[model samples]
Target: MSDDDAERPLKRHKPQHEHQETNVTEIERSPDFWFDDGNIVLQAGPTQFRVAKSMLSRHSSVFRDMFSLPNPTSESTVEGCPVVVLAGDTNTDWKHLLAVMYPAICYDLTKPNIMTVISVLRLSKKYDLPAFRKESIRRLRGDLPSKLEDFRKLPVAGWLYLGEVSDVQLSRTIALAKELCLWSILPAAFYGLIESIFNHDGSYRPVGLSLADEISLLKGYARLTRLNTEAPNRAWLEAESPCVPCDDCLFRTLCRSRCASLRSTLQAQQAGPGAVFSGWDENWSDEFCGPCIKAAKEAYNDKQLEIWKQLPSFFGLPDWEELRKMDLDAGE
Candidate 1:
């Protein structure tokens, strides 16, 4: 017999009771899953999903190769259908991935739940599904700030929301970013983790962060502290302005107060330098007239951009240009 044929078990004459027991077992189905005219049965852990092999193979090379394997007589079957047991992946993750592949279901790739996006990314990478992997990466990169201007505008609450996603835990996301070589996201992800570690009073509140993560945060925090202290000195607050008179003009005075206020706020909250630029409108009171406020805001925006340029350095990372080049070289 050929090697392929040798792999198959020979038909053996079985007793009536053995045959009956095999038939009964074959007829049994998992309650959680229903057959939908699907040709393949995929079992992950205790859960089983009846899905089409063609649909899966269309998107995943791994699945295509797996299904292409010659079936042996001794292989397990579910109701005479091929049973593909996937022990490595969780049921929830498999279901999430399948939801993205099937045309009958509407899965939003853009604003997918964080865990769903992570699941899709992980499975897609494993199964060599380039399209799904790209979509997942796009979704995750969407959450982060790509431009220097946007970094200052990132919402603090948004970071907390990301932390709340059960499967997309903050620590795990950091590790995954490193594994996937997503260098662009490291600064923001580290910032979010550092921000999450503090209470309103700036007390260190451990939220199940790993030791390595804690060390990285501490190192990043030290750098942020230096940046926050030096940020005001770099502000573009010119002494002379057309909007204010020479001697009695409160423009320079107000500008100084604003810078001091920003520094004080940073110190009080023990926040990263990004915090000084973000959410400022709500906290800023009009201590000066409109012209002065306008001028100050203009200068603040320029200073904020400057600070953003130094964000990677605050986390001991390479500058934007070098990081971008690295990402390009890696084909990311």
Candidate 2:
């Protein structure tokens, strides 16, 4: 995507499935978050939750303000309680929010439920529920952590648990992060998407992302591929570096034999920025001379670290510190 592509029309939004139309006389009750003695009815889509207004007002300033507004003398009621049909929200979104907020059946955030995190995050933002929003962001950061060390611990498919998320959902995560101004997660999110493409065959299209984001990913992917191609394989893209000074008679051959032997493995192992080269074995050091061993361990890892540090810039994002600062300022 480019600035000039602003006029380029994208495919029309085609939903996989439409929301089931509920009959006016057949509104369904929520299995959870439905209090029998509740004084308010919150409906979204087809589902309705009877809940205590005091509790909602206590947690959400938006809700408090909305409730404090003067109601019409002829306001409609459901079961004698005021009905607040929240527009532009899905039943799932309301369900997740209420599940997390409800005292008796508080939803556990420890579970790896990205849907819960996302849904709660959206409603929490809209309702100004600071605590829930903060916790939801924490959960998102846990999955797409900023640190390279933490990032390496994730699986080969690059993000999400087995069968827990698909590439389409991951793409949606990118869109959500951008929309919410959660800039800190962008680097790792993009890296995860690209890494999945190379190593896991993940195929992401510009479904919900903007043209700028699409362009950013394309350029970043090209740059990452170049980096991966040159990564520590042939003396790390600096075969005759004056820094190493391995041209001496003793250091002659530059241990090229040992370094060359490992090129195929190194090339195959490296996917992009977070490439930890887990394929490397310490036992392989026996094949290297002293200087060559240092180069192998230190120089190679330094390159990957460099890539990790550049992750944000690769996607036209501010560096990690600036992005982190933005997130902090937003919270404030």
TM-score per candidate, in order? 0.71, 0.74
* Tens-place lDDT digits, model 2, residues 166-221: 55566677888866778888887777666555443324455455677778887887
- Cα misplacement distance, residue 297 of candidate 1 (Å): 2.9
- Cα-based lDDT for every prediction: 0.60, 0.66
Name model 1 segments beyond 4 Å from true: 1-34, 102-110, 152-156, 159-168, 229-274, 279-285, 288-295, 322-332
What is the number of residue pairs that collide in model 2? 0
**Worst 10-residue lDDT window, candidate 2:** 8-17
lDDT per residue for candidate 1 within 71-189, as digits (tens), equals 76666655556666664667788777876665344653244567767778777766678998887776566566547556554455553123244322666777766655567777777
Give the best candidate by lDDT: 2
- The positional error of residue 176 in candidate 2, measured at the CA in angstroms, is 1.2
Q: Report the C-alpha displacement of residue 159, candidate 1, in angstroms.
A: 7.5
Off by over 4 Å in 2: 1-27, 67-72, 103-110, 153-163, 199-211, 232-256, 264-286, 289-295, 328-331
Task: Tell me which residue pairs clash in candidate 2.
Answer: none
* Top candidate when judged by TM-score against the true structure: 2
